[model samples]
Target: TQLLEQSPQFLSIQEGENLTVYCNSSSVFSSLQWYRQEPGEGPVLLVTVVTGGEVKKLKRLTFQFGDARKDSSLHITAAQPGDTGLYLCAGRDTGGFKTIFGAGTRLFVKA
Candidate 1:
C-alpha cells in the first residue's frame, strides 16, 4: 500500500497572505486529487491531476503534479478567511480504486 505524507500539518496566516502546502509519496500514483474539509463536513473535491507535469489553476489557487507523478502541491494566493479548512491529498494506485489519503494540513486564515 502506498502512503502519502503531507507537510506542515498546520498553517496559520493572516488574510491576503499567500501559502503553499505539499503532498508527497515514494510510490507513484496513477492519479491524485486535492480536497478541503471544513469543520463537521466531509472534504470537498478541489482538483485532480491525471497527467505527469500537469498544472491546473482554479482562480487564485494553483495545483501542480510532479513529472514523476509521486508528488503534488497546492498554492493559494491572497488567501481569505473563508479559505480556512483542512486540506487533504488523496492518490489512487494504477491497479485499483482504493485511495490513500494524507493526514491533511489544517489551515487557519485569520481576518
Candidate 2:
C-alpha cells in the first residue's frame, strides 16, 4: 500500500475565488489520481497523472505531478457553489493493485 498526505484539510471560500490543494508522499507511484465528490455519492475521477513532471488541465482546474513522481497538486480557479465538495488524491502502487487515498480536502464555497 502507498501513502499520500494532503494539506489544508478544510477550505472555505467565496464564489469566484481560487484555491489549490496539495498531496505529498515519500513513495513513488505508478500513477496518481484526483477526484471530486459530493454528498451521498461516490467520488468522480477528475484526472490521472502517470508520468513525472506531467500536467493536465480540466477547464479551470489544473493538476501537476512532481518530478520525482511522489507528489502532486490541484488548483481550481474561479470557485463556485457547485464546486463545493470533497477533493481527494490517490496513489496506485507501482507493482501491485493497492491504491491509497488521502483523508481528503473538504471545500465549501459561499455564493
Candidate 3:
C-alpha cells in the first residue's frame, strides 16, 4: 500500500472553477513541498511549508500545513486552463533522509 494516497486522485473541471486537493499522512515530516508538473517536464515547485500551521499563498494558489505537521492541503482559486497539470506533495520524514511523495493529483481544467 502507498504511504500517501491523496484524495480525489483525478479531477476534471471547467475554467474559472475552484478546487482543493488534500494530502493526509500518519507520519510527520520536517518539511513539505508542493509542485506542478507537465508532460515530459520536471515538476515546478509551487511552495514549501515547514512550520506547523503555516499558510502560504502564491497568486491564486493557497497551501496549508496541518498543525500536527502530518497533513497538508492545496487550494486553487479561479482555476484557469493553465492550471491543468499534475500536482504533487512530497516531504521527508522527521528522521528519514529520502523524500516520499503522495500519489499525484491530476487536474484537467477545460476552457
Using TM-score, give the best candidate's number: 1
Q: Name the weakest run of 10 consecutive residues (lDDT summed) in model 1.
A: 92-101
Cand. 3 Cα-lDDT: 0.91
TM-score of each: 0.98, 0.96, 0.95
**C-alpha RMSD of candidate 3:** 1.4
Which candidate do you rate higher for lDDT, 1 or 3?
Answer: 1
Q: How much is 59 displaced in model 3, in angstroms?
A: 0.3
Could you tell me the lDDT of residue 111 within candidate 3? 99
Strongest candidate by lDDT:
1
lDDT for residue 88 in candidate 1, whole number 0-100: 99
In candidate 2, residue 71 scores what lDDT?
97
Question: What C-alpha lDDT does candidate 1 achieve relative to the native structure?
Answer: 0.97
What is the C-alpha lDDT profile of model 2 across 1-111, one tens digit per residue? 467999899999999999999999999999999999999999999999999999999999999999999999999999889999999999998885888999999999999
In terms of lDDT, the poorest run of 10 residues in model 3 is 1-10
lDDT of 1 by residue, 66-107 (tens): 999999999999999999999999999988678989999999
The models' CA-based lDDT, in order, is 0.97, 0.94, 0.91
